[model samples]
Target chain A: MAAYVQDAIMLLGDSLTQGGWEAHGFAQRLSYVYARKLDVINRGLGGYQTDWAIPVFEQIFAKEHEQHHVPKVRLLTIWYGANDASPAPSPQHVPRDRYKTNLSHLIHMVTSPASAWYSPDTRIILITPPPVNTYQWDGRVFDATKSYAEAVKEVGLKENIPVADVWTEIWEAAGKDEKSCERFLSDGLHLNAAGYEIIFNTLIKIIGENYPELHYDKLQNVFVPWSEVNVADPRPSLVKRPAMIGLAQL
Target chain B: MAAYVQDAIMLLGDSLTQGGWEAHGFAQRLSYVYARKLDVINRGLGGYQTDWAIPVFEQIFAKEHEQHHVPKVRLLTIWYGANDASPAPSPQHVPRDRYKTNLSHLIHMVTSPASAWYSPDTRIILITPPPVNTYQWDGRVFDATKSYAEAVKEVGLKENIPVADVWTEIWEAAGKDEKSCERFLSDGLHLNAAGYEIIFNTLIKIIGENYPELHYDKLQNVFVPWSEVNVADPRPSLVKRPAMIGLAQL
Candidate 1:
């Protein structure tokens, strides 16, 4: 069994989030930078919408009693708008109003003390889905997704959660032209490496600005550096320590 | 807190393994393929030797009594020898005999029934360190490193564990030319994307042959596919399921 040696950064949402494990994707980049500091637990379910995600989140996020045994989720990224923005009649679609409610509900599951999954230590950053390239795919409308992205920001504001508004960031990167989004979107829906690079950079900047303590540069490896390991008496030095560089250690 | 929804593949070793979280590295590739089926927990500590790793492993691997509370380690890859091959007098150096013993000790910690961390479900693959480009770096000697690689093979043979002979694979890929190995190695020490690609493919092949049941293709997602979810009553469908496709389910 894997032990709770390090806390985790859990990425939760749809295909956009699941694809974060791809090379050069945001999740992979985060894992590389936060290598020894935190484990990246990807709870991204491809093709999932906020409506369907609520129940899944309930099961995946440990209840209060189970928390003592599991790794703490130091950071949580809830990125969902993409699939939920699908036009009505598409099974993946969640109405914009309901989408906002679902996002908030997911957030409160951790932020609200009354909820079974509450964890005050878990800092969250909500992400708005990237812009769609209408010319490349017809599964979604550019405007509809834009509305869903807008809905996400509203929820973030109401919940006081930091938002990684990749939708607007990608839109401007594409010169506000939907077709130009092809440079970032592989199939007009999913992201390419270049697209994910933007998400990774945007996310890191958000971490630095809002949760600087959790920044990779600010955290230490849970295990001591090789040179620092006491060679003559290595066992004591080898025990896993907290990743945080406390004032005492400093 | 993160719930244990999936089993895991734990990668344990030195810088070579730590670097696996980098883009296009073996860890990222495995996480991509095994996305929903199994979470990839990286326990790779940089600049670590088999000697330093044992104590670290004791804390990072859950003991038998604690196993029920944590995620099962379905697969483990022990890749060491790069730093240990450092010449005598270097702090990182472990005599060839002791290096072999340390490697076996790590395997036995999980495989031995009487061991505290014993986990019979965890299948292990022993990976030989990639061939070093002696012309580009003087930290290690080519022949000395080759001897360490041979030692890993001996350990795997004696332990009856599968070995991902990446040393031979990378050497042959470099046309057996020391300087040409720069094509795969970034600084003649750590691997480049091309080098990691070889490790990923070779490891996959070993898994296919030795532990076919654990392959990503054979394992179902712990969560139901969106299309298969019982939409009206998703709570039942959303409950976490084992990744294995049982005979009845098939």
Candidate 2:
């Protein structure tokens, strides 16, 4: 097995994060800014509600960690709610009461000592679903999203985790300009490149202010600098002893 | 070390591959298309010449394998030549003879028995640099890129590896219109989203036709479907004997 490991930050959510994987995309921006320092893993599952993801999270975080030699996860951004906010009739929708329960359970399962994937150093940031442009999301009810976002915020506060309120952040970034929502949400739901930009920038700023240690400049690259590479023996550079302590269950 | 290993496909190249990490980017498409099947790794280094990468290659591939547990690398794409095409005065430029030598060295090192990283079943593809709109890339002499591309094809032919001649393919895909070049390149040098779309589609098609086993439908996600998940007993899904035997040096 290869020994190279980078501290990873996970983007856990739904289609918004999936769409954020594009060029100039949200995850891509973080990747660009953080390059060798940390790998931004996109765990975004399109069309998924929080309920389905709970088990998937166990696989990716808990079970996977129990089995695989993947990198240590340093920061996990739990961004969900888009699909959960679907109308009650939609299969993707989760009832408001259950939604809050799911979010609260998710936070505790991942961060609490009662769970298998818990690591004291691993920071959890909950992100609410971004504001929806109703016309583009099959006439999705915008109020439903706000309510779900509120649920996420409540869990973040009760769980003592940081939160990136992309829902409010995106709308405010759009300002009073008419149709500016179009600039942010390409299909009134999924964000366009511009919409992701605001989210990406905002998250980076949040990390800088609240999780300064995770900042790009503060972290080390996976390997030695090009100048320090041993032209005659370069293997040592990529094989720095992995700093996995406190980062992974391993 | 983490025991779970994800089969990986490495995109080894320069800026095109690096920039290709964007939304609907080449690697992202592979990630989406191959989710749960194989991990698509971006080993793209910007502003790198093949010579500089040769040792770094050993560092990333061979030594790291000797030290840690990484998922097996089932497929690797060696895409280079863009930076090498920089004019004679540029530090990034390598002489024509040396460029071919470097490409040849790279192919053999990764594929032949002389290297520890070599595995007979590991598929290797050589991707020539994409079409360079001469006026956009420093008004570069077009013939230079064409020559380097031809050199890559020759190596691929001699080594019996697949070659993606993006330089020719993109141009033809654009239908040879006078300014069709503009549609494929964002800065007369790098590709825009439209151009990447064609590359992403073509690569997927190539995998379908040539590397059918690498197709998405044929692969398995890293875990069991949520329905089959034990909920009470989840580790078995992730600990399944790794399919890494024929895939990595490990």
Q: Highest TM-score, which number?
A: 1
Residues B1-250, candidate 2: write the lDDT tens digits.
1223356787777767777666657877776666545766677767667867776576556443443445567778888888888897766677878987888787777667766666555677788877677666564667788788888888878777788778788878768542578888888777778877877777766677788777676665454333454434544533433333233222
Clashes of each: 0, 16
Clashing pairs in 1: none
Question: Which whole-number lDDT from 0 to 100 does residue B38 have in model 1?
Answer: 93
lDDT of each: 0.92, 0.70
lDDT of 1 at A118: 90
Off by over 4 Å in 1: A247-250, B247-250
lDDT of 2 by residue, A147-186 (tens): 8988888887877878888888887877843246777888
Please give the TM-score of chain B in predicted model 2.
0.88
Native-to-model Cα distance after best TM-score fit, residue A36 in candidate 1, in Å: 0.5
Worst lDDT run of 10 residues, candidate 1 chain A, spans A241-250
> What docking grade does candidate 1 earn?
high
